[model samples]
Target chain A: MYWITVLVVAIMILSALAVLLLPNLLAAVAASSVVSLALSVVFVIIRAPDVAMTEAAVGAGLSGVILVLALRRLGLWGLGDDNHPRPGDSLQGSGDDA
Target chain B: MRNFTSLLFAGGLGFFLLVLAADLPVGAAPMVAGEGILGQGPEAVGAANLVTAVVLAYRGIDTLGELSILFAAAAGVGLILSGMRRRADQRPDPEGGFILLAAADLLFPLLVIVGLYIVLHGHLTPGGGFQGGVILAAAFFLPLLGRPGDSLNHAVVNWVEGLAGGAFVLIGLWALAVKGDFLAPMLGKGALGSLFSAGTLPLLYIAVGLKVGAEIAGLMSTLQETEAAEP
Candidate 1:
């Protein structure tokens, strides 16, 4: 049972990483949340409901919100109508000064 | 561009997972520790919850050390943010975006009450000092967002911390003085799984919770004051 749980968690973590590196920050955040929830489930199986609750609250709840907020702060999500050449262009230009 | 690296990473992880799965144990049972100290015995140490027993009885000193570590972290946050402060004459308008303000107001009270509930029932249920304390800290953040100018009075925080600290010490001392061992259950352990069980553990958790809440709140207020001062 423990091994199965571990295998499930490992798969979730790998999937999360795949989501993270797929060039979409929102997708990455969602993937990370899945990983956290999976780990929390594993914690519950191990009879640590308190730890599972904390993980779900901190890892899934707070972290997802924080990630979206940070993404917004960095100007990732915006009005869909704008024709702005992806903001990464200006960011790359700024990097050239270094 | 990033696909090749990601693919390699994924492959490596898969290989590692296979290796770990190959080494699985068949069936596991609940772990038992210190057969004489934990199981049926004369001096059962009074606390019913085994986790609480371990925390407050067998490893009281370790818990004390953990509390000290948290204290150090809170102090470090204060020190780091204090030196980077702007001149007092240049305080910015405390107002932030409207959404942040309204959301903070709505969440603060709920967080505080829930945090208190968690702390009070820690001995009976799953939560304890650290979790409850963090929840309390989160509650304080909302107010900081909604009203940056209205700073949490450091004096009140300090007083609460001092009183809690004092109570913790007093209880420990009482246990030592009466029972000849520090942190021995001074009060009645009560029925198993009851709210009033675990003797001093619940009270200790409450003190630790208040201290943690105050420290985190102070840190939030301090950081906000500094950031609000920033452009």
Candidate 2:
């Protein structure tokens, strides 16, 4: 049981790390949801069905929607850094004005 | 350039996780069942779930502090956003489809009712304060996204919060008066799996759910108002 738990925990931790480390913000967010869902499973295994339910709802469900909303608010949903100004624009003084 | 910062953040997080794994138990927490009413007292604390018992009875003060923290955050958000109010720059959705609008309107009350049900039966079932509270906030938020200019009445939110807080304290005091112990079980301990078991835990979870819902809704409204005010 302990070894299985360790494996699951390691997978969750790695997935969460990938979520943070990945450059694709949406992928990162999806990874975060995966991590949360996995944690809920862990909670259930520990005889905390209530906590597991709460974790799944808030951490996985609500927060996923909220993060997507936030990402939309910030205009970071689909487009990537391809639209950013060329690095030389810093010398052109367009960088600091905003 | 942004990727560099993200990488650094990831590395730092990984380091922290390693430290946590080294220190904390990585396996299942040892489950030691609490001595039931026979060892403690008559189980009438207004809850049926033992988890609620640990949440609101054993750690009542901690839960209170958590609620206060949420309240403070709500207040801080309101203060910060209300001061920055301007004019609405974004125009209301003129092309809002009838289907979308109707769906939102139809779902709002149902969501609120479900959230309230979860809050009310927190101790009786597998839901509780934080979960129901967040759901309640979402019920309000869903409409805000669909209907542009709609806003919550701040007064109603204040009343909800005030009443919930007062109820929590009053319940605790009543326990003290009746049982000679603050936060003691006040209701009859019915059958072990019944809804009326576990004394005061259910009541506390309800209070917590209401308080948290009010706080989150208030915070969301404050932020939304500021964003709406921005032109």
**Candidate 2 per-residue C-alpha lDDT over B99-207 given as tens digits, one digit per residue, 9 for 90 to 100:** 6678888998998898988877777777888889988988887777666477788999999998998888889899889988777666766666666666666677788
Chain A TM-score compared with the true chain A, each model in order: 0.69, 0.73
Model 1 pairs whose backbones collide = none
Top lDDT hit: 2
lDDT of 1 by residue, B102-146 (tens): 788788889889889988877667777767887887786666655
User: lDDT tens string, model 1, A26-88?
Assistant: 788888888888888888888887787778766776557556544543447542323433322
